[model samples]
Target chain A: AQSVTQPDIHITVSEGASLELRCNYSYGATPYLFWYVQSPGQGLQLLLKYFSGDTLVQGIKGFEAEFKRSQSSFNLRKPSVHWSDAAEYFCAVRFSGTYKYIFGTGTRLKVLA
Target chain B: SQTIHQWPATLVQPVGSPLSLECTVEGTSNPNLYWYRQAAGRGLQLLFYSVGIGQISSEVPQNLSASRPQDRQFILSSKKLLLSDSGFYLCAWSPTSGHQETQYFGPGTRLLVL
Candidate 1:
């Protein structure tokens, strides 16, 4: 079964500092990875996705993720953290040409001023 | 540009009461629709998904059911609500024929079952 895992349950960072959230998935031949962000009491918004080609993918709101095939990891990163960026982040994985997507429990990010 | 809508934004129901949550998609047709529930402090649990009208797929054996009556309308229902059903319900839609793209999400409807 294909599954995703977010190792860090909670991460705290100072504003204007670089941030990275780790994600790993069970080994699969063709894994389509995605990152989503959810504000408190709001639905998740897609951050970025990786289907094929480049290992690094850029997304909305100045977020980016690098899909490493060898490690089965898709880690989300930002050059600078903002107070508004404090939210829950989820990593989802889906096989090619499939409807099912397995999501991680999520990592809660806290940005300190 | 496509959009998904879920309502009534928030609902409060008593245990054993009936439930009917509606989801619809616009600016697109024949898109795949999905129903997911996010329990408090937990990851999202996919309840159901539909590829076409009247073709619903249940992911887990649960107390809820879903239906896709029209091309763009999907509904989640339960005959008698349970306290476990209290959570945030989210509706999402993806392309029926694509590269397994990202699913677009609605604002979500918070359901509180007392």
Candidate 2:
């Protein structure tokens, strides 16, 4: 079974500071990884995805993630944080031939002004 | 461009009451539809998915059921609602063919079962 784990439950960062959210997955093979963000009372928006090719994938809103196969980790990073960037982040994993995606518990990001 | 829509934006229902939630997709055909629930402070739990009309696949055995009568429409229903069912219900769609594996989400429907 493919499962994703987000170690941080909540993270607080000051405006203009860098941010990193950790995500680890347990899968038999290299799975399709994705990062999504959800605002309060809103649906999730895709931030980035990694299917193949480069380990580092850039996404919307200046977000980027690096897939590390050896460590089974796909961590999201942003060079600078803004107050509007506060939201819940989730990591999802899907197998090559499957449609079902397994999501992590999520990490709540709080950006301070 | 594909878009997914779920309604009503918010719902309040009593326990033991019947439930119905609708989801529809536009600008796409033969897409895969999915129903997911997010409990308070929890991640998404996929309830059901469909690759085509009348082909519903359940990911979890629960009090809810899903049906796809049309290629673009999906519905979630329950004979009797439970308190545990009170959560944010989301609808998503993805291309069954092609190289697009990303699922686009709807605005979602928030259900509160009293």
Candidate 3:
């Protein structure tokens, strides 16, 4: 069985500060990893995804995630977060040869002034 | 360009009532469709998925059922709604060919069961 774990339930960061959301997954083979963001009362938007390539993958809205196979982690990061960046983040994993995505519990981001 | 649409942005239903939610995709053909539910403060739970019309696969066994009448239309239904069914339902589509697996999501429908 494949599963994703987001360690942080909630994270508060000041405007213009850097942000990092932790995510770990358990899978038997190389996994397809994705990061998605959801605003209040809105559907999720795909931020970035990693199929197979460079470890670091850039995504929309200046977001990026690095896939670390040895550690089974794919953490999302942003150099600077704006107030508008506040939202819920989720990490999802799909093992090769599978179409189903296993998602993490998600981390709520709160940007402060 | 491809887009996904889900109807009834918000819905309120009583327990034991029948439920129906519609999802449709545009600008794509032979795409894989999926139905997911997100409970309050929880991650997405995939309810069902379809590769083609009349080909539906359920990931979870619950009060809901799914149907695909057309290539782009998917429906979720329930004979009797339950309180646990109250959640945000999302419709997503992914290209089955080209080896692409990224699922694009719809605006979603929020359901409240009383």
Candidate 4:
């Protein structure tokens, strides 16, 4: 069956360190990919998304994701982590234009000053 | 520009009590609405979605029920609340037209069942 996986359940890093969150999907065809961030006691905000062209996609708050078809991965990256960036990140995928979205188990990022 | 609204930002109910949560979307039309539950330290679990008024599709079999009385209004209810029903409830809306599959989420409603 098709699914989305986030191997890391929790990650901690020092401030100003680089960050990478992995997202892998199992699907026959190309799917729509998205990354979202949620702060404590709040709703989720869209970080980035990938549709068709351009493997590298940039998003708000200095975040980017690269979509690799061969590897079936869309990993999020940040050059320098901030203390305020400590939050939970989620990866979601949709096979087609359908309304249903499959979300991965989320990864919680903790930043240390 | 579209916006979503969820009422009763926080709710506390006892077990066996009834549940009612309202969600409304403005600045758009013919949107695909969805309901999701997010437990503590977990990702989102899709509960229900609606394409049009009075048309609902349940994703999981649970004690929860959803209804779409108006085009932009979606409500989630339960006849009797369960201990497992305590979580953060979110309402979302996506456009039906265009290939824009992005979903806009509303401020979640936190439910605590005692």
Candidate 5:
């Protein structure tokens, strides 16, 4: 039973401000973690992913995430968010034995002017 | 380069009507295909997945079924549509031989059940 939880349902941040979205997962072993972003009425796009080794992972669109094993958390952070960054973010996990992905409830991001 | 395509960007069907959503992948072979449903303002829910042709694994039991007629073709069908089935349906594919796999999603099909 692997699952991911995103504590924030919605987050509003001003343009040029730092953004951090929280994500926690419950898995027995070292999990494969991913962060995806989806615009309204569009498919999801990969933001970043963590398999092993480095605790921090960088991805496209200037997005990054840190995998904290002790806290069971993989939070996404951006130094400066633009208006185009406003979208829904999802955290996903997958185990070694399966190909299916377990996704978090998702966090809606709103960029304020 | 690999790409995924799903047809009928948006669909509206009545209850008890049948469903047929097609998904195709290009520039890849023997990909692991998946069907996912997402409700408004919710996360993605895995409905089914396939490793090869004629092989389908269902993650959740519902009024939905999936089929892989070809190595790169996946289809989601239903004998009778349900209101709960109205949502955004996404088709995704990933490499079959990877430890840390990342799925690539199609443009997605929005379904509305009346």
Candidate 6:
């Protein structure tokens, strides 16, 4: 079964500092990956997605993720953090042509001002 | 652009009460619809998905059920609510056949079971 794992349960970063959130997937073949962010009491917003080509994918709000197949990881990164960036992040994986997506447990990001 | 909408931004219901959550998609047709639950501080748990009318696929067996009576409307219902059902319920739609396509999410409905 395809599944996703986010190692970090929570992370705290200072404003303007760089940020990185880790995500790992267990799948036999290449998988479609996505990153979503959710603010308090709000629905998830898609940050970015990786379907094919370009190991390094850019997303909204200055976020980017690199898909490292060998490592089974797609880690999200941002050059600088903002207070509004404090939210929950989720990593999702879906097999090609499949109808289902498996999501990680999520990582809570806290940005300090 | 396609947009998804879910109603009753927040709902409070007692255990054993019935539930009815509505989801609709606009500016799109023959889209795949999905219902997901997010526990506090946790990942999303896909509850059900529909590819077309009368075609419901359940990802997780729970106290909830879903139906697509119209091409653009999807509904999630439950005969009896449970405390475990309290969470953030999200409605999503995708242009392609299924999860292989990038999904667009609704604002979501927050349900609290007392």
Model-by-model lDDT, in order?
A: 0.93, 0.94, 0.93, 0.94, 0.93, 0.92
- The stretch of ten residues in a row with the least summed lDDT in candidate 6 chain B is B95-104
Worst lDDT run of 10 residues, candidate 4 chain B, spans: B95-104
The collision pairs in model 2 are none
| DockQ, prediction 1 | 0.77
Ranking by DockQ: 5, 2, 4, 3, 1, 6
TM-score of chain A of 2: 0.97
The residue pairs found clashing in candidate 6 are none
Candidate 5 per-residue C-alpha lDDT over A1-113 given as tens digits, one digit per residue, 9 for 90 to 100: 67889999999999999999999999666688999999999999999999999899999999999999999999999999999999999999887777778899999999999
Please give, for residues A8-108, the per-residue lDDT of candidate 2 as tens digits.
Answer: 99999999999999999996555989999999999999999998999999999999999999999999999999899999999998877788888999999
- lDDT of residue A52 for candidate 2: 91
Q: Give candidate 2 regions above 4 Å deviation.
A: none
Model 1: CA > 4 A from native: none
Better of 2 and 5 by lDDT: 2
Residue A65 C-alpha lDDT in model 5: 97
- Per residue, candidate 6 scores C-alpha lDDT tens digits across A1-113 of 67899999999999999999999999666699999998988888999999988899999999999999989999999999999999999998878767777889999999889
Model 3 agreement with the true structure over A1-113: per-residue lDDT tens digits: 67889999999999999999999998567698999999999999999999987999999999999999989999999999999999999999878777787889999999999
lDDT of 4 by residue, A1-113 (tens): 78899999999999999999999999656699999999999998999999889899999999999999989999999999999999999999987847788899999999999
Give the range of the ten consecutive residues with the poorest summed lDDT in model 3 chain B.
Answer: B95-104
How far does residue A23 in candidate 5 sit from its true spot (Å)?
0.8
lDDT of 5 at B45: 89
Task: Report clash pairs, candidate 3.
Answer: none
Q: List candidate 3 segments past 4 Å from native.
A: none
Q: Provide the RMSD of all predictions against the true structure, rounded to 1 decimal.
A: 0.9, 0.9, 0.9, 0.8, 1.0, 1.5
Considering only the true interface residues, what is the Cα RMSD of candidate 5 after superposition?
A: 0.9
How good is the docking of model 5, as DockQ? 0.86
